[model samples]
Target chain A: MEVHSSTAGAAAPPLSPGDFRELFDSVDAFLFDCDGVIWKGDKLIDGVSQTLDFLRSKGKKLVFVTNNSTKSRKEFAKKFGSLGISVSEDEIFSSSFAAAMYLKVNDFPLDKKVYVIGGEGIIDELQLAGYTGLGGPEDGKKTAEWKSNCLFEHDKSVGAVVVGLDPFINYYKLQYGTLCIRENPGCLFIATNQDAVGHMTDLQEWPGAGCMVAAICGSTQKEPIVVGKPSTFMMEFLLKKFQIDCPRMCMVGDRLDSDILFGQNAGCKTLLVLSGVTTLSALQDPANDIQPDYYTNKVSDFLDLLGA
Target chain B: MEVHSSTAGAAAPPLSPGDFRELFDSVDAFLFDCDGVIWKGDKLIDGVSQTLDFLRSKGKKLVFVTNNSTKSRKEFAKKFGSLGISVSEDEIFSSSFAAAMYLKVNDFPLDKKVYVIGGEGIIDELQLAGYTGLGGPEDGKKTAEWKSNCLFEHDKSVGAVVVGLDPFINYYKLQYGTLCIRENPGCLFIATNQDAVGHMTDLQEWPGAGCMVAAICGSTQKEPIVVGKPSTFMMEFLLKKFQIDCPRMCMVGDRLDSDILFGQNAGCKTLLVLSGVTTLSALQDPANDIQPDYYTNKVSDFLDLLGA
Candidate 1:
């Protein structure tokens, strides 16, 4: 199978047939960023199914690596299934899973609870990691009025405050998370992904996990330990779990800052696709320093480039 | 009248009786930060009334200035009356008032509406400034789930999005404000103040206007035009309206960053009071670059230092 492949940074050289085949021959695994690479919103990118089939048929390990913490890997896999794609939960490496893996890898205290300020997927991942989660959608309806006189109550046993992309984010969660971080001794502040905005739907860009994280950061006057893309936490987790050589894995996505940067930090080959939020002009703009090892109009170019 | 007065940054000289009288006598008007300088939570600082009376008796003008946009001038004046202090709406300069004044001073289009993600006070002030405000507590109860497919409707006539100290801040307002700033052409993003935390009550420090501002800032990926303290917009408005001389006016508050820096930026004398958020150690902390012209234990010290 021929593929888009080049080395180093910006304006990677055009790949000849031999270069393409040679790069694919060395790659043993492919890491896909779901949103723009596999699909945009609810619709799958054309020929992506065929590309996945070709990669799997060639015995390449495939994993969906997404910064969206809005859904757990189980739910994310279901989304793929609904899109007429075959995928398993184990092959999904969402930021929610990364957050859970982070806690697990760091040997978080099992007895202490986690205070969440995000979607239910984070709670699901936390539960799977053997920790009870508090303050997800349950706190969405709760609110604090201006000039609230009394101190609000919070669980004393909270060991961490994990923030992610929460559509139901409100002031209650902001204040609660701040309390957990500031008042609760040694309470950890963690973020799944700090994406400023996300195409939760293609109709528009909405506030993402970064807004929630920024609110908490403004209150507590501290930065969280981000466990999502570009942090290399997920890369290390993938390395330890999948036993794949970093140099042999190719990370494909549309975002330069999140996906390509994550791949670069992971020591994996990076591919940028233009089917999502980033435009071709933005990629070619001189101000943008982030460069992918390879780039194409879309991930489906893999199949088209092969003349399959 | 006796007072705390010195020159330059860092520690200024301790005040002598002659120095105190000379300083106070030179001041024709005093601008006070309400929450911390005038009162702590519900209770007014001891001798604040006597100090106000003493200032008024000496024919010195007094204006209450606060970064809090949670209440309009009318409501704020009522708060003063409740505390047994005689204050009028015209004698108050709140961030809400400043926000309204900013739009008016800038000659914003009268036909265009405003989208708000803040307290009712901002809405009230906007109405007073002849602009209709939408999406405040009205949108607080609105909910948006993860992956909401439809784009929420927004008024195309919205000319600006004003954010302030919103206790009812939610994702709906965040998204709405984001849409206005991003989609509405030339729509201004205005923030009343960006104080990181506030003593919403003396018992606890809750997230302040900065959190709400930060949330929108994250979503819109834009920095707002701050019209509150340390920005000089309010200072310019106060000067234009009240006809006060800059050098003769003393800005008194318990916080260094907001009140003191505001005074400095406005080219007026600044007084730091230890009765509120700041302490002596924090004042002495070399890491802090903000230095007031003078400092004292509390505003009440104005009367005590008189040796009455």
Candidate 2:
């Protein structure tokens, strides 16, 4: 295995096949950001399946970490199956799961319900964690009333307001969530992720969880406890759950802010790939503070390391 | 007419009946903020109708200026009629109308269309200004597909994305609006207002147009040109449209941030009424920068000056 050493403060150079093999050999566990590194939209990245197979053959622990809270871990695993990659639901750690785990770890009151301003994934996770959730897709439909004077029947049992990505996000959800946070004493404001945008395809990017989170935050004048990537909460959850050594774990991602920053905060080796939103020029920019330990063209480039 | 003097840079005390008469006599035109000062949640403030009548009897040019973009000028006029107040559509100026006027004044391309992420008010104003509008409530329904892979057929003719208060706001509208702004070359990004929350009633307040505007802004990283109160654009539009003398115009409102600031910025006398969102303590707070020229308990307080 080849080793190309560099100073800690400076940006690391792109990794060679042999250098990547050496790095891969050192790490026992791999945490991957799903969207850019493994797939873009519905299509899977070429050679990713073979790369994962090689990693598995080397007895490496593969964990899929994503900020997308629209789908539960089981659903994500189903998506993986459709993409021709075999993944267990337990091996996938989504932000929604992290949020649920957060509530569970905090010993949240079982009797109190959580008001959700998101999609099914957060609700599924909350339900799995033995917490009742209200105001998801079922409460997302537009009311027939002329004026927005629908008297929201306030439930005093609501102890938390959880926000994530909601395709069916409307004014009512925001209103109810705001009411929960503002009126309910000791009500927690939590966000699964604060991703500004999600790439649907190369040319198509849409507003993500951050938009909804920002909307709630803007109205309530309250900052939520974000539990997704870039926040140490998700990483801490993974560390506690899997008992993986941070030094021997590598975080492979395509985005600098969330993915690479999460790796840095998690005290893991980080690799940035050029296959997604980030560009080569962005990596070389002197203004950027967050730099990966190593970078390559794409996650599939690790296939060359296996050959080496 | 009565006169009372106060030290400069101090919070103005509530006006006496005689002092209010003096202020009223000085102004030939009176601009009102509808929600709090004139009415609150479908209920008209007592004595408001009589006070407006007295002002009209004195030959004051009354204009209903509101940041609410939900209803068009004609609709607003109808609402006024329902509230037992006679008003012409031309005398009502809303944020939606301001946005349309802004485009028209700037000589926006006639061939280009506008992509709306709002309600009917903005659409009506855009149409009235001879610009084709797309993607409002007509495109707000949730699509059948599970995945967010809606084929957003981009129209190159879309030159602006106008956002207002939309109860039917969904991911598709946000997605389509973002696409229009990012994909269309030099497409204008405009917001009617950035009001954080709107009061539906005493017990209910919901996220307003600002929440939706903030969502789009968070995703696009693009700052929109806001045309509502406190922006100066709306004031400028009103000033030019009516050819009103600034010194002879008095702005009456319940909120300090938008209404009072707007009046101050427009070089007009400002009257703050405690009938709305802000309280006496807030007005008296030294930390607050925006202050009105005159203060009253309510718009109806002016009635005492007229000996009603």
Candidate 3:
């Protein structure tokens, strides 16, 4: 059963088929990041379909986990199809989706306009959930002279302020948003995710929505109720969706901090993928030894080993 | 002249006009905030124009100080003209302009694209001073996915990261910008202002660029080279611009934490205005007793006493 523990304790070269098979035979459910492993900017990984089909044949569950707050469940499904991968909207878990659901169930002020500084996914979800969306004036010049009250109406009944993924987020917006929450002390503030960066193609990383959330939270002395992965609420939702036990299930992801930490914190097996942000070189170094219970190069590579 | 000698050390209502004049007679310059003091949205304060004109006739210097990082000197000039106030671009000093000038003179990074999650003042000033500007992708759909490396050939070569008035700044942007600077170890990061909240209208106080700057600086473990008012650098700049000794000049403004503190720290006379952010009550209370050399109901009222 202990197939190749040699690479397990250390960072090593890419695994062989035998090594992949030896490692993947122990996991039940799998979680994954979308951009780096299964595909890169619309091109599917070399052998992803076969890998998914093999996993499906073995009755293993697959869930796509992403910190990208820009895509909704439906949009993700469409994106997967466009990239030649078969995934239903239900197979995806997004920070934006979790935030929307959290808002809907918690009796948050939905009718009031949510000052959105993020992407289509967050905007679309807020709209779908029957919340009004507030936009800054059309001209960028207006932002300079625009006051906080002018940016958002002084409806004493304004609902919560939701901050999702916004790249153009600047000083005025931060100022205005902070003012609104500070002025209306009763309004709830929510951030979709707390990710600091996302792994892009070509091995470059970019800042994510979490950085903004942290900044505003620090200023206002208010922390957001994060709705994405590693949060027990989202994990609990996944458990209910698949009717799985939190203890016996497995959580597989490429990120050691988010995925592995989430798995460990939730009492599940953690399988760290070598295909994304966390590299084998980092894990294998004696100075840094945060080893996941299982290891694989990519989603498809792990599937090959799971056939045992 | 001895009106305040009886109550010099005793707690009293902030100096009345007669009491204020008896204690301090000579006033050289007047400083004002643009928003609530002079105008709200595109409208001037009732007596703001006439008061400035009278002061001009008396050959008194007037400078507008704003914590707003969204506009540059030129932009503020145009805004002032639109609001029926006579002003040259030089008469206005924004935190962005101050920070930009600081960066340019200090030779921080002249060639790198400053990933600006801020306003045009920050962008335009940096661009004019010979730095590239990084913004959200034009596609709009790829807004969240926008990365800065596209603007430059290599990420390591990034010289400095500047943050101003960006409402859409998120965790991704903050983390990436911070990491890039942290990894390089020599990259200079500058923030426009440090005011936590500014009153946009009588109704609300918006968070300022300082909040975001605080977050990034805290994360990176670096203090920015601040050029905003109240900073010693700014006092030095004013000293050089006006060719006046720091002790002989005066800084008149509405806020105590920034304006009054600036004067106090710079060894200049500080005049507190009742028309803006901090109230007379806050100044008199022992808990927040930040007494200015003089206090006036408004910037205009202070000008009246100057025989303008």
TM-scores for every predicted model: 0.92, 0.90, 0.70
In candidate 1, stretches whose alpha carbon ends up further than 4 angstroms from where it belongs are: A1-23, A146-149, B1-9, B12-19, B41-43, B146-149
Instruction: For residues A1-308, write the lDDT of model 3, one tens digit per residue.
Output: 11112324555345566655543455566666676667654456677778777777778788887767777888999988886678898888877777777888888765566665466787677777777656332212224344434554444554676776565665556665666677766777887776655554433555556666756775675788777766655676677788765544666676665666666667666667776666777666687545566667777665455443
Ranking by DockQ: 1, 2, 3
Q: How well is candidate 2 docked (DockQ)?
A: 0.40
Provide the fnat value for model 1, as a fraction from 0 to 1.
Answer: 0.64
Which lDDT tens digits does candidate 3 get at residues B1-308? 00112223434355465764543335566556666567654556567888888867766677777767777788989888887777987678777677667876777655555666566777777677777766422111223444423432236666677765455555455655677676776777877767666565555556666677766764554677666756756555555666655555556677766777666677766667677666767778777645677777775674566544
Candidate 1 on A170-283: residue-level lDDT in tens? 778888898889888999999998888777775666788889888888777788999998788887667777898888998888887788888887788877888777777878
The global C-alpha lDDT for each of the candidates, from Candidate 1 onward, is 0.83, 0.82, 0.64
Best by TM-score: 1
DockQ of each: 0.54, 0.40, 0.21
**Backbone clash tally for model 1?**
0
